[model samples]
Target: MNSGTKQHPWSRYVALGDSFTEGIGDPEPASLGGYRGWADRIAEVLSAGTDDFAYANLAVRGKVLRQIVDEQIEPVLSLRPNLITISAGGNDVIRPRSDPDEVAVRCEAAIERLKRDNATIVLFTGPDLGFSPVFRGVRGRIAIYNENLRAIAVRQECVVADLWALTEIQDPRMWAPDRLHLNALGHHAVARSVLSALNVANVLQAYDPEPMPDGTWRGARTDDLVWARTYLAPWLLRRARRQSSGDNLLPKRPTALSLNGPRA
Candidate 1:
């Protein structure tokens, strides 16, 4: 499939945020940083017909809004990209006692600084987690944050990749085994949304994950117990210790360079 007639205006693009932008769950060992995330997917589509198109991703995992503003802004400014996508505040929003409004304020500050060069900025809303057995408890908080992000997009004159409205992601199949980050299917869904938000046409297709076999109630409970022990318990321990999964990790693709991937 080919891209649509709408020609995108950007030649240089940069991505900034946490694990969602970093491609945490979609492991591609051959790709830079060993992941082909939504940003990378977008870069591929945007670079399809243009040799001059260049991209950079400065997103590290486990970064809060303030950390993103502090750590990523300088590198992005240095890139001087014409297009930028940022998905911050998710980490903050999920933390205990964190205020969504405050997170939005920090996000606005970041956007204010980023748009100084008149770049087309794109912001992402956190997904609706109403279907997640683990994260459903925080659904209301995420909704508030999404509203804040929508308002920020309007005031900042930026585009919004409204993940909160993408109903396809509400399924557990769209999530990674850890249930925090997106799997490949979820990342692809996000890439498609980003392109739509930019009004860029692409050939990416909707994918349906293989259906899970039905399980007995006891089996499901046992699975949950195993998940808690393997993935959840360690995560809680890290939070207790004030540690992060991305501690000391560097950006996968820090420089803006032409992408090489399967064309649309």
Candidate 2:
């Protein structure tokens, strides 16, 4: 796990986003409940003990950009994280009343607030929802969202993770049965992408892109993956399957289940 260079272990990281940041499709779901996620993985790679640094994942499912600003962003400022990673905007895209321009503005404001604390910020854009049949007609909107995110990253001097491009080249197995959420492999891909962007060491050193158990899709089965399925994937699949079968399990929205953004 060595990077052939001296690097100080990160002492604190505050992760902000939705379900994707929560590792929704990881194999074993129980492990991801508390502070577990890519941010936790990165923290472990950089440091030896949990007390050495605090990694907090302040993400919740079905949270839009405004919600993150109110809930996660404001409270985390007090932690004074040495590093921060935000994976947001998916819910904003999927919601029926989503205004892309307002989302961009909110995102920009969030980034600015983070900058005031002077932590190394990594801002991840939404993945390519276009690849899924559910999001078939809104590829253009996804693209515009990503473009605005990139602009904000540039303006605010934040590192950007090109999640859209990374997911675009992947096969179907990378996504969960619901197709909107990332499977185990997709989560690893996202972790690696973020690590590479930050020049972090040993984060993905032992990464293996394999599928989960129960004859599921293709991807890696890291601890994070195990956590994802046990907790997050089952409900997602149930909802998706129910919706596909014309069952009204959840609230009715303007878009199909597949078009529900990045499972976040």
Candidate 3:
């Protein structure tokens, strides 16, 4: 490699985390996982800049921080890519039974290893979960996790793609009907932010926000009943059974490949 050559934030990029990194709500027809997320979106933009640009997404839909570190740490360290982003821990701390301190400790350990690589590591805090009445109780835990994440980023010298301060993330329309994952627009907002943080060229050009909801609470109780019956009940059953959304699923894009190339 030429020492004087400029790098474009990433030539080899990798993403790691949970559902948010996996693109749960943003539908994709070609991939079996059925979604294309911020990582993919950023990869596409990078691909436009250089044919050498490649990307890998190892994020599954439901892994917690420790699991993510266990599954991803060695592979990512081996890959030694120039860029990486991790968006985990939400699945762990969102539950009433989980410990925020433990999750943070696991995450800090993971970030320390990621920092050992020459690659730039980008980190995103889980957005405010309080907007959903169902997760209101866990807001304190999420807040604590966010604070820990911010401190960890500083210590690791990793770029923090801060989500907690994003004003519009609290809007009802920014989320999916399930109220746990982000909808299309919410994903777009995140992608934009992630790219901007990377100083990717013309990131603002990717702007396509989901419109805020009108009369979102026109029939609050009726909607709550539907939400509970449709999404909450199944989630509880999964927890009781010790199951996960990513169970039987695989990363949609597991190996680094150019955006215009086939997945490896």
Candidate 4:
């Protein structure tokens, strides 16, 4: 997907956050951690024509906002990247009784720390999930968080990849089977958005969704039952046990490296 040939100004880029940044839904067996997400795709474009460019991804699945700031921030400082993209707090906002305002405060603190080096920062607004069956209840909370991010980006003078406004994400075809994460198509759309926000030219193009399968009302209900039984139940159980998908996992790319060989 590294189609850009023009020289971009960024020499170093680092991605930070949770599953979304880690490229969970878009699996790649050849990639580190079996994922090649939007961050990796963007890296390919950014690395083009830049001989000294390096990229690192510190995102892990199931990481909360506090963990991301407390754990990943220090490593980012050490990397001293000229460009950074962070998408955190989605895991927090979805929790019961979680306060979007409080989450935003923590996020702003992280933003303040990252700004110290005067690097170009890109922030993401969570995608609108109102169209999702399982996540529709949390749509309001996500919206509030998205607004906070928009304000933070303006105040911090950071670039924004506004996923809330990315209408393509609302389509069910753009998501993975889990419904919580984006599929390959969704990740591609996000990569495009990030490139647009950064004003970097790339040859990435839009992809059409596969044709929807015909279904009856009973079939839809049956699918919902299967989804809940498979994904939702397990996720709830994990929360009850205070378990995480990233419990024993490490960052796919813990340090900046050349994007010259492999994909992720």
RMSD of each: 1.9, 10.0, 4.2, 2.4
- Off-target runs (Cα >4 Å) in candidate 3 are 1-7, 203-221, 261-264
The residue pairs in collision within model 4 are none
For candidate 1, the lDDT comes to 0.86
Show the colliding residue pairs in model 1. none
lDDT of 1 by residue, 209-234 (tens): 34345678898789788888988999
The TM-score values for the models, in the order shown, are 0.94, 0.73, 0.88, 0.93
lDDT per residue for candidate 4 within 67-108, as digits (tens), equals 999889999989999899999999999998999999999999
User: lDDT of all the models against the reference?
Assistant: 0.86, 0.63, 0.77, 0.88
Ranking by TM-score: 1, 4, 3, 2
Per-residue C-alpha lDDT of model 2 across residues 113-159, encoded as one tens digit per residue? 88986888898776666655556567777778889989998899898
Off by over 4 Å in 2: 1-9, 27-36, 48-51, 167-169, 203-207, 212-264
- Which candidate wins on TM-score? 1
Full ranking by lDDT: 4, 1, 3, 2
Clashes of each: 0, 16, 0, 0
Error of 3 at 149 (Å): 1.1
